[model samples]
Target: MALAALLAAPAAHAISGVLDTVVIMQDVTDSYKWPREQLEWNRVVAQLQEQVHTTERLVQRADRMIELMGTAENAADFSAPPSVMTPVNQAVRLETTKHAIESSRNLFRLGSKTRSTYNPANEVKATFEVAGATETRDENRYAHFAMQEAMYARYRTAATHEEEVQGAETALQEETLRRLKQVKTEAQIAVLTASLAASKQRQDLAHQKTVQAKADLDAFRAQLTTEEARKQEADREWSETVVKRMRDKALTAYRRQFRAVGSESN
Candidate 1:
């Protein structure tokens, strides 16, 4: 009877070991496959990232296109229409970029750790601290590259718009001078002078309009620059927040795994 009981004990231990392996395997699989709620959050985050990247690239390209249009001598020609198109295009692009950013922010808020009632701030701080101790320089390099590209593009566009306005004014002046050369008699000169005065008045009005437009453009560009800087800072903060949350979740899972292993050993 003692020999039979001892033999049965080994069989019972083997059965328990098999059951434990199955339970652990199921837990690991479930852990790896995120819950439906977390999966939705991840999807939102991915979408926001893609939209932000796309908007950044679009703004950058628009800036370059505006610059390239500005550099040509005949940019103010009626056929080109760049004077009106450039600013309008930039305004549209900027508005689009702004919308994209706002949308991203909404999605980020929706998917944030705070939404889960998780204490993300401490985790975020720790993540950033770790990143700072390790790969901060690399992250900064990429960030600067994006920033420089956007700045150069914006500057080139603004410069181009200013040049276009100047060229248009210069052309109008030359036209006025050429008309004055054709005057002969006092009557003709009087008519020409009156027409010239009117033309000058019109040119002055146009110049004023140009100056106002340029001012508005400059203001818009400055706003964009300020917004971009704010966005960069926000992105770094968000990254830190995400890292902290992930680290906390990972540690929790690690502890659970340790406990499971210890139980299996017993």
Candidate 2:
């Protein structure tokens, strides 16, 4: 019996050791808390996604506006000026007078003593004086006509040149406005493009953070599951220990009863 008890003692000690291990593993002293950081990261990811969406919408709007501008015709700011009859008549008269002056100048260049002696400045003064008998001086006829024609030509040339300069300036201003508008559109598109790129980059970073957060949350859940399993194993081990003790007591009582019965029969 002592030898049997010695073998059973080692078995009992091994079983107790197993139960102690289970109890140690099942220790749940630490309290559970919500995964706030992980949840907050998820929320951050959602907000970033919304920002990316909004930026994409703005970029699309900018692109649509650019397309419309490309296709749309610009209305003229002002109509072309109408041809004036007065300017046309003045041009024709000037041309006729210019030819007459050229012919008179050629004649004067012939080195005639009378032509050399004729002073054109004096003839011009006399023509404008309003008190001269101009018809009586047939020799000064060419000089007077040349001077008068030259004055008219100068006036008409100045007026025409000024009109041309004004027209050129107006055209240059219109072209400058058009170029400025184009540059503004280009700038807007470039800004939107850069914003889109930045938004996408932010979204990617947010997604990476969210993934990492979720991984951490999953690891935490796994740890909780392991702890729960350990608790269940500990409970099972405790119930087995109770049953073993009761069985041992019942066996001892039956053995004693059998020995007494045997003694009585002898």
Candidate 3:
């Protein structure tokens, strides 16, 4: 959108300048002034003016949209902006814990449900653990993606801010040029001269705002990476420890039951 602002606004002035030049040249070509040539320049000038005006309006709309996206916050408390992609920073992984006490016995076995064919109690419990771990991982992942999106939003807003400053400078420059092209009082020229200097200072401040936004984004991304890694690793360790204990207890019970049955057969 900002790119459109840059290209269309300048073309307007260039097109108008061409039309003015053609009109001046026509004054010296009284013998053979092709009416079509001057007519085409006039049409081009009209089109360019409309394009410039439309683009300027769109830029204004962009600014309004940015303001509406979020309420103002203190720079020191720059938390997450209102986002459709809200991160579950602290997610609940209780499914695995709930299913950890599931019962399993060989008495319920039948054809195709033999030990090798069906999931054992420990295995079912492990499946629950795996599921919880996967969800934990997914929650962390989306959290990271959301943070990155916020960073991108800041970058995009910064870029738009710079483009806005450029647009203002362009308008002031065109105004100054127009005044120079025509007869103006000394006071009128001085006013424009002073306005141009003020515009330059605004441009500098806008540039600084853009730079600071990008820097903030970079810092946030680095911090997010560290936090995501820590969460993933902690969940992994927990899943592994719980599942291992569940499997070991199931195995020990099976071995003791097999021995008692062997002594009875004797």
Candidate 4:
């Protein structure tokens, strides 16, 4: 199996429909029911988090999208966007996804370590210590060894479960993608329209927050710069003088004066 395929192997708390990730990079306007749309949206978000490794940009992008639509609800309710908004905001959707993926890749460079740690027992090395040595352990060590064996058995069980999930996901991938891309009925379009309207309402509420966040970020950056400069000035505030030195010499200099390092033996 590919290294990535192995690392992101199923975990106990993993979300369902997550492996339905083969998106058709198209200008999608399918009239799927709001609930199904919601499911697909969630799957995309979950997959992005898993594949890319972080959700900072996803959150930011979601915030931005909500702001654009002029409603608070869109932030949490992605499946049902406003029907009045025609053609769908493909740029926003694709850009948000691209940014989300990129941010995760950068933010979680060490994600593999965390992934391995999830199955801690399975991560055990073939040659780990027993009584401070790898080979020729005493009889007393076997109990400890046996305890580890039990732990490893649990790991094996977890691995088996993961493999089953992977197999199921593999079978479902194509079908899920096709479902997402399929055309919708008139009734489905009506539902989608309502979903879109709700989404737009949420998008409307998001704009002011986005503006406020940008302002806050700038202010924080400026404050940080000013504070850093003040810190540097404070570091140089003390004078390096003979009178000052006499009153309070540094510990290293004091140690050097008292100890003859080259000639000393403990």
lDDT of each prediction vs. the true structure?
0.51, 0.50, 0.52, 0.44
Q: Clashing pairs in model 1? A: 123-244
Off by over 4 Å in 1: 1-199, 255-266
lDDT of 2 by residue, 1-266 (tens): 99998866533222324544632333232222236566889999999999999999999998787664542233222222233223333333333334535565444422333243347654322223246644332344445444333434344454564354344434544554454455434444344344444434433443443344345445544655687699999999999999999999999999999999999999
Q: List the residue pairs that clash in candidate 2.
A: none
What TM-score would candidate 4 get against the native?
A: 0.20
Task: Give TM per candidate.
Answer: 0.25, 0.28, 0.33, 0.20
The residue-by-residue lDDT of candidate 1 on 1-266, one tens digit each, is 99988866533222324644632223324444577769799999999999999999999997776554443342322222454335434432332233323343323232234223246552321123454574223333233333333333344444554455456545655665675575433444445456545544544544454455446545666876897899999999999999999999999999999999999999
185 in model 2: Cα distance from truth in Å?
A: 8.5
Cα lDDT tens digits for candidate 3, 16-127: 2454463222233443456878889999999999999999999999777654443333112212222201211111111121121121122122211322323455332112
Better of 1 and 4 by lDDT: 1
Q: Which stretches of candidate 2 lie over 4 Å from their true place?
A: 1-191
Stronger candidate by TM-score (1 vs 4): 1
By the lDDT metric, which is better: model 2 or model 4?
2
Best by TM-score: 3
Kindly indicate the candidate among 1 and 3 with the higher lDDT.
3
Please give the ranking of all candidate structures by lDDT, highest first, separated by commas.
Answer: 3, 1, 2, 4
By summed lDDT, the worst window of 10 consecutive residues in model 3 runs over 84-93
